[model samples]
Target: MTAAPTPPSPPPRRDAGRPRGATIVAAVLAAVRAELAETGFEGLSVERVARRAEVNKTSVYRRWPTREALVAAAMEGLLEEFGASPDTGSLRGDLHALAAPIAELAARPDGVALLRAALATTAPGDVRGAARQRVGPPVASASSIVDRARARGEWRDGADPQQAVFTLVGAIVHRTLLEHADPTGEWLDGLVDLVHRGVSADPPP
Candidate 1:
């Protein structure tokens, strides 16, 4: 009998040699956030994100196939610095530190657009939460800042950590996105002072 003919080999995967690790994850997530800010949720496309990330579309699809999943993954890495507010040693200091960067971000056009994407009522749930994480994290998901403050007996009567955080972030977003004003350092200080007083167990100085 004649020997069976050899079978043809399957084609290699498009990302066969691509490095799949933190580097790829970081690039992909970064691309998704930039995409969300510029093009927004409605305009976001896997192809564009892949191109910006310099990775194969297959790679992104393999990790985050759905819009919700992609946005959630993007959020997982966003504003991570804000997640852990270091021991500023006082509630006022902590609040100031936390508010400063958010204010700074709001001052930029990209930041304004980015905030618009997050605060959009029509955006998917996860995308909305990502921008809110600037303050949200300090309350639940991210840090010990609130816990530390509570332990120090710093919070005033009926002042909830969640609400306190929301208030601080909300002011920044309103000023930068709605008012279309720069979140100047001077302004941030004033905002922090106001929020600090509202939440502090002691009265404002």
Candidate 2:
């Protein structure tokens, strides 16, 4: 009969109807960082992160699959927040510009704690890989500075670009974590000057 016509089916669920993955990912990562900052990695858990993020546990698992992976992702976000590379047109200026912000980040207790937690839990290779990613932009910036210096005959062509980057960063990290020293303006300036002198192609007139 005409009265027996079937009712129309409901519309299919679409990804467009759900929260954007980027938003969810940001929230989750933020939560992970917060957890790390508050409780350190030893106290971290999927449930705690899920609660903090207000997302399902399954969602966190789907994305990160493990606590270490989640922490790595959060640490990666922290590195990204360090901002872009500096290009002040000279090697010294670039080093000065880059050193200030990195020192500032190292000064933050939460930032240092997060770094420690990641180092404690994650594999050394993985940590190094993440570090490479974190430092990639700054290294490239330093390389550009090196290139400019070479063009101007301020630096030798055979200088190692990576060594230049590591020198400043490694020293900052050492003083921050080991010596318990502030990476103050005076310290940073001296560090830059020292590195510049060591790497310069010719003695300053």
- The most accurate candidate by lDDT is 1
Cα RMSD to native, each candidate? 9.0, 9.4
Report the lDDT tens digits of candidate 2 across residue range 1-205. Answer: 4578788996532222476598778888888777765666677788988877777788889889987688778777555655555567776786788677777877775456555564554445564365356645656667667777777777865677789778988888788767878876789899999888777787557
Instruction: List the global CA lDDT of all models.
Output: 0.73, 0.71
Can you give the lDDT of residue 59 in candidate 1? 87
lDDT of predicted model 1: 0.73
Q: Give the residue spans of candidate 2 off by over 4 A.
A: 1-27, 35-43, 47-63, 81-86, 121-128, 156-159
Model 2 Cα shift for residue 66 (angstroms): 1.7
Worst 10 residues of 2 by lDDT: 11-20
Clashes (N, CA, C under 3 Å) per candidate: 1, 0
Model 1 clash pairs? 154-201
